[model samples]
Target: MKILVTDPEGYVGSLVVACFTQQGHEVISVSQANAGAALSLIQLAVTDLQNFDAVIHTGEICGTQALHPQIAGNLHYRDAMHLANLAKAAGVSRFIYLSSCSVYGAGEEEYVTEESPVRPQTPSATCKAAIESDLLTIASAEFSPTILRPAIAFGASPRIRFDVVLNNMAGLAWTANKINIPGKGLSWCPVVHVLDICQIINCILQAPRPLVHQQIFNVGDTNHNYQLIEIAAMVAEVFQVENFSFGHHGFGDRGLFMTFDKIHQFFPDFQCGWNPRQGAEQLLNFFTLTDSIQSHFTLTRSPYHRSENHLFHTVSIA
Candidate 1:
């Protein structure tokens, strides 16, 4: 199988490219550098798109920084729509969109399923929900669009992100010997390992067309939901840090507890191999092996901050 992956240098995108290439699939990738101009070229290069069997779009303004409406609209919604159109134009049948469980957004439900109403709170989540809706609307007999709403992704990647909750706590525990829980640490969040997300993409690509076509799947283990305080404790245990504290202020009420039953029932072969404990352990090992110091842990370089033309190569891993 041949695949075209966007934002191959991104946290999940990098892993997705490596996973597919390792599985003997031919993978062609495009970075998010100069998205507008690059996508304009891509439009002209429609013939090139025909060479791929599927498109895995992970190229978007991710993380909390995507709260900016203009940035989110252009990078997340516009770019995605353009890519989908190009893919469809090139006769690409399978378009797997990397949406977010954040689209469920601070719901009152105990467990939001794929069917649950999307109440996007942030601009980032709103763009995601909008993209999902538009992509579904464009679905056809020839074009099958599958949406994977992954939970807050953790675990290490070649393009590691420390902005996320679990990873941030792990870094703090390792460097400062303390994990700080903001606002009483009461908000709930679902997390999945970076590797698990890659695996889920592979499973979807391999599954029968009927099973995934126009389907929305929340990607995370049902058991992996944890309160912010619980996550802090888990990180503390893994890093062997004794000091962890909570803030006196109130954290935002936004929390999402997602059910993975739809994905599990649809693709029985899919399994979540890493939980918070294992993920923390992996991060600890990664930090130790890399000799990561306080500086490395403290510097938060989000993709949104990168130069528009900044490009990265696919990380080759064994």
Candidate 2:
């Protein structure tokens, strides 16, 4: 398999590149600069420059995504739209669009299926949903465009983001000695480990024609959904923070739990190796090690202090 990936420097993109290479697939990781091996010289977006065995557009635009729509979310809308067009024109064999579970909207409702009426309330999620319809049109007899909507994705990345639930818990527990909760602490958050995300990407790529062609599968494990407090408690236990405290920020909020029955049914052997504990623990360890070094005398005098703060603090979007 010759895989061409855009945004190859990103967390998930890098992982996908690694997955393809480790599996003995010839991989060409393209950024905005260099196109792939066979791409010759064309340009608009990275995808526009390459034709390969497959194209997985995992490029991202990040900011806080919530109920209300935002202008920043439109960034992804424009970027992904161009990306999809470029991939299609490049004559890629398979195209996979990395979407978020938030397309299902946020709530505590259990087992939201693929057909369960997409309710994209937030700006970012809304953009994804809008472009997805276009992607589905490309899923006809000629091309197979697979859409994978994953819940909160966690793992090690060149860009480690702690704003996500599990990683945030680990950050605060290690730094502030607390895991903040705003409401009943029972709102469900569906989570998927970064590795499982990689495994499923391979599964989708290698799958037989009729099975995955032009399909949308919600990727997750049986433990996909978890109550907020339960996840926090587990993270605390993982880090041995037996007495971590909680503070509420918002109220009367609910979240939707996702259904993975469809993907599970298709890839029966797909196993999620990392749970909330593993993810939290991994985050905690990273934070601890980094913090330990930063707290030292010589290191404290360096430029890394503010860099560390940038990692933990949510900068107000200007």
Candidate 3:
């Protein structure tokens, strides 16, 4: 299959490109700059969009940039809609949108499902929810948009990110010999490996059109829902760190816990390949092989670092 993937240089997007290419699929990558360009420029830049079998949009403003409504609106919502419209215009049948599970914000329910009402708290989540709604509205017999709301992605990638929860804690534990848990570490979050996210996309692209058309699937293992403290402890154990502390106050973002039953029900063969411990171990190995130090763990050193603080943030790439 010929696939056009946006933000192929990003963390998840890079992995998606690699995964599809390895699977013998022809993958054309578009950077964020080109994707967000003027419509006329985009049309000229990416010619023959109709020839592609699918357009997987993984480009957006994430992390702190997503905190601002204007930035998130222009990049996440407006620009994304532009690309989707272009793909639709070009007769692209399968449009896979990478959304976040953070859309189910601040829920008290034990497990939020696809049917659960979206209560987006942050601008990022709000934009994601809005985009999902608009994409579904634009769905037609010729165009099928499948939304995958993946949990906070962790694990290793060619474009590694130390800003996420598991990665940050692992880096801290390795370099500083301590894992710092912001707030009381009580907030719940679901996490999935980067590789698993790519796998889920592959499954959706391979599945029958009717099975995924206009569907929103929460992408992660149902059993992977965990508390911040639990994640800290896991990192501490994996890195053999003796010191880990929690803050006195809570982070403003609401926790998200989701059920993956809908995805499994539709694609029974799919399963998350990596758990938190395994992801941590993979990071540990990465840090070891690279001889990563304290400076390497800092935000200033890595372009992939998104958060000012290394603790877990509600915002993440799918």
Candidate 4:
């Protein structure tokens, strides 16, 4: 199959490109500068998309603060709509949109399913919800659009990030030898390995058209749901750190418990390959191997890091 993948240089995008290429599929990778520029480029490059089997959109601006002015000012909604239009104009058969579970927002609800009413509180989630709704309307017999709402992803990427919950705790344990547990660590959260999400994307693309057409799948396993303190304990164990201190930081107290039954029913073969223990160990090994434990702390300490101090901090909000 021939595939057109956007944001190939990004963490998940790069993994998607590599995964498809390894499976003997032709892949066209492109970078979307912004909504307006991306639309113009797509028009100019329309002829190149002929006979393409699918388009995987994985481009969006992300940050630690969703309500931050800069994040709210991003063109993700426009960009995603334009990408869907591009696929339609180019006669592409499939469109895969990588969305986030944050669309459910924060509430006292114990569990969130795909059928849960989306209450997007932040501009980022609002944009994602808008894109998902628009793309579903574009789905037709010939054009299959699949929306994937993945849980907070962890594990190593080509573009490694330590701003996420498990990774951040592990990094702190390995670097500063101290783990900061924000809040009471009792809030529920769902996490998935980056590679597992990539595999789920690939499966959705390869599944029977009728099975996934216009379907929304929450990606991750139910067994992977965890709390903040549980993640911290796993990190400490993985790093073999006996002495760890915890403090209450005002950030990352909110949590969303996402359900994954839809994804499991759709792709029974898909399994979460890594748990918190494995993911924490992976981060610890990567940091130790690169001798970048200190680097992780340094970069994540200030304005350079864009990841929110939570489980669902970094991801493509397509």
The number of the candidate with the highest lDDT is: 3
Per-residue accuracy of model 2 over 1-318 as CA lDDT, tens digit each: 887776665657778887788889988765532432333212455444455778787745453344334655565566666666666676766888888787877553556877777877656777888778778875656567888988777756655666667776666566656555535676777788777888899998888867888889887875668877888788878776665444454423466677788898899888888888888878766766676776774534445332333444441100
lDDT of 1 by residue, 53-138 (tens): 89999847454243567675656676788889888999999999998877877767877998899988767677888999999999
In order, the Cα lDDT scores of the candidates are 0.78, 0.69, 0.79, 0.75
Predictions ranked by TM-score, top down?
A: 3, 1, 4, 2
Better of 1 and 2 by TM-score: 1
Misplaced by over 4 Å in model 1 are: 34-44, 63-68, 248-254, 292-318
Error of 2 at 134 (Å): 1.2
TM-score per candidate: 0.86, 0.83, 0.86, 0.84
lDDT of 3 by residue, 1-318 (tens): 999888765779889989999999998787665542222224432356878899999856454364577675656677678888888888889999998887887766877899999988767778888999999999999999999999888988877777677877777777668787766787777899999999999999988898899999999998998888889888888889888777644453346677899889888999899999999999988877665564667645554232234343332322
Cα lDDT for residue 194, model 3?
A: 92
Candidate 4 lDDT by residue in tens digits, 1-318: 998888766667778888889989988777664332233333435576779999988746464235573454346676678778877888888899988887888744779899999988767778788889989998888888999898877888876566567767766676556677766777677899889988988898878889999999999998888887788788888877776555554434657777899888878888999999999888877866665555656654443222324432232212
Runs in model 4 with CA error above 4 Å?
Answer: 33-44, 64-74, 242-254, 292-318
Which of candidates 1 and 4 is the stronger one according to lDDT?
1
- Clashes (backbone N, CA, C under 3 Å), per candidate, total 1, 3, 0, 1
Question: Pick by TM-score: which candidate is best?
Answer: 3
Which wins on TM-score, candidate 2 or candidate 3?
3
- In candidate 4 the C-alpha lDDT for residue 42 amounts to 39
